[model samples]
Target chain A: MKVKFLCIIALSAILFACNTPVTESEKNGSEQSRKSESEDSTHVPLATEKKVELKREGIFMFYVGAFEAKKMDTKKNPMLENKINIALDSISGDVIYGHSVVAGNIRPFQGTFNLKDGMYTVVAKEPGDNKYDGVFTFTLSPDNGTLNGVWTSNDKKLAVSERSYDLKKTEFKYDPSLELDGTYSEVYNSYNAKTEQHEQITDDAGKLNASQVELTSKDVENMYRRDLEIMRNAIYARHGYSFKNREMRYFFDTQVAWYIPVSTDVTAELTDLEKKNIELIKRYEKHAESYYDVYGR
Target chain B: MMLGLSTLKNKRKYSLLVLLSVYTYFLWLMIRITLQYFPAHDDVAFLSIKQDYVGMWHYKLAFFIHVFSAIFVLLAGYTQFSESLRKKNPKMHRRLGWFYVIVTLFFAGPSGLIIGIYANGGTSSQIAFCLLAFLWMLFTLMAVIQAMRRQMSSHRAWMIRSFALALSAITLRAWKYILVALFHPKPMDVYQIVAWLGWTLNLVVAEIIIIKKIRS
Candidate 1:
């Protein structure tokens, strides 16, 4: 009995250790079937032929340019070439791309477009000086007729922009309608137009705090630098590619006509308005050196 | 006076065996509950097999068989050597033995074989658990056959070995907790070593009991 038990144990041990050919084939066949089934189910969008109507809308366009530093050293904010352009194209029928040559070799250029009232994405590609590109998505509503959004980099809120402002003030107030909650439609419609026109009164002060808070030039520059460093690290780590200069220009150029209806009545006048906004942005760039001296790292 | 003394000794032996068997059954229940709720570790290999098999229909069928058969085996193994129970209710005891042996052959043994292939923690853990499970089924089969042939002593010895393997499920968990208490946050290496030692020790104790019974 003892010898039989020992022999049975040895035989069972051998059987378990040896992977027979039959089991191997069975495992492979099952894996292959699962793969084929997964491949069969892919999503395809519906194709529709109906023309969509867009309402007449106006957008105020301007550009904001700044630099970012690399590394977290307290001694000096390393001169990382991070430049960004923000163009608020207000009801502009023509899309215009322009560059400004400012003092201290700081040139900020932008492309403007008036998009239809719906969801639109603004992709600022390798915007000349910045090592990294940025993509911003915002909704253009017929009622609001403005682009109001915040820019964030490296998980930090960088800047906030509004339709009318040429230079983004550090201490600008925000309309409560822009808060992310689904309550924005009510706030936008219920406000007394006359009171808001005379006094910039926001409906919800506490929720709009982040938008109202002003960031110093130094803060903007620091944020820009950090964003650039993040981009550089991502590229070096083989995670993603940096946007080429031409690709950036092409995206901004293509989207302009879609935003600004070139065939409409507001085309010619809107073009001049955009040109003026560009000049105002350039003037701000001239004072940017002093802005950097006080605020830039 | 000598006859009375021998009877008392027999009574003591029977009582000790019964007490140990009952104690082991409760310990097995505790181990099962612990494993059901608080599993040993969450390694990838263990997770993958569990995801693919344990949660599937086929595996569920097998698991039910193994669990129900184990309960029967525990009951039968506990009362098999009970002198008073055998005298008072021999029919009931025989019925339980037959049920336990038959259920184990049809269900527990086959399910155990299927699950043994996917046992985690690599080859050694797989070998330890799979061999233990297979040996359990084999011993129970032999015991049932031997009892049918009226080889009562042989059947009893094999049943002891079969019960020993079943008790491994209990001993493994006990040793795990004991090591956990002693070491206070031991690593995977330490636990693996303990798993091996614990199961082997239980088998050795069962073997010692079997040898003693046969010699007597």
Candidate 2:
């Protein structure tokens, strides 16, 4: 009986936890950060530039030399060359590849180059179309190998204009990494991943806890009975049963009267009908007493 | 001569079974047609009939219960009448019988009750369908209890009534089709009349069979 009660509590807790609102601190902090970032001009500069060298080899492949840009722009001046490589190969039917240019109609060039220790700007522009331009600002190391500081752009047309990161030898750490909170948009996109992870964790925990609780077969049977009762109440609501006291009494009686016990143990103990009847009796007595105690006739 | 007479009786019985089987098959086809073709909601036939009765959840619950119960009833009725099947597969027959009873009790009976109370065309139709669902559940429950008690004859009689109620789902549609075809009455009027007549005729036929079987 205790184990059955615990199981009910556990199940209810899990459900409540899933539906609980995100903590106020988390929401407030994130909102404040967003507001501060939007207000801070230095965090994201208006424009920057960098030099990029391009080398063309195969039909679609090009070896892009190291280049720098103030801010990486994905839209007008796409720095990702793989996209350009793919688009070129698709159009020309050759396995051509390049470093900075992304495959497709919209291609942006991007690369990394050493610069003297100082604040610098990097820019990418289409040959003749001034419409597409990307720039970024960063401070170079005295050794001419390290590019440290913030990358920002003024162009709103670019998909990705600004990012803050520290770059050393071969490592990069980008700050203000995006995380999906449990909002509608995030939930829709992350549903499959979140649900799968939840299920795996819950199943494992449930198994271990079941053993710790030492729930007898009878306890599990009672838990199922309770689940059925809840299901029947939902059904009753669906059937438009008035929420009056008498109707509720009848609904409770009917549900409790029909609940059958499920046996998970190997021992063949009670016959099906006996088990069913016992469950019904137990449910009836429990629910009836509680209802009267709470509602008073 | 006796052997020939018995053989003839068997042949007649088999022919009746065949006819019932065909009728059931056609009934299922009609139900399938209605589900597939009928608009999800009708302004005239559904909404204008009654104010208290119209809602999305009501319609959805009604449709789901109607379809689900009809399928179970079809399975149960088919097994009940199949002689070769019953003879060769008694276990399957028993299992299907229990399934039919439980499903009718839990899903069909309650949903039907709710739908019946809100039935359009007036009080008479409401009473008719309410009684139909109540009797359907009552007979099935009795059959189950009796079977549990090992009262085979009583169980059989109750089962026959329960199945007759199940068959009303099919007959109701058939009656609707015929009414629309012949008189072309407004859909609401036809529904009201068919709701009562369908179950009434089903019970009447079942009573006759029960009387004859008892006498024999």
TM of each candidate vs. truth: 0.38, 0.38
* Deviating ranges (above 4 Å) for candidate 2: A1-297, B2-10, B13-17, B34-59, B82-84
**Model 2: per-residue lDDT, tens digit, A1-297?**
423433354345334534544221111111110011211111111121211111122122221112233355445544321111111111112111111221112233333333333433333222223233333333434234344443344455564455443433221121112111211111111235533621111111112122113323223221222232332222222222212222232322232222111111212333343344334333432432232111111
lDDT, residue A144, candidate 2: 42
Backbone collisions counted per model: 16, 27
- B1-216: candidate 2 lDDT, tens digit per residue: 999999999998688657655655554453443343244544222232232344567755775565456555655654565556667768877887878877889888878887788775568788988999899999999999998999977887898888888878777877877775566454346667888888889888988988888898
User: Looking at model 1 chain A, which ten-residue stretch has the lowest summed lDDT?
Assistant: A25-34
lDDT of each prediction vs. the true structure?
0.40, 0.44
Cα displacement (Å) at residue B73, model 1: 1.8
Candidate 1 stretches with Cα past 4 Å from truth are: A1-297, B1-28, B31-49, B55-57, B184-191
Model 1 residue B26 lDDT score:
53
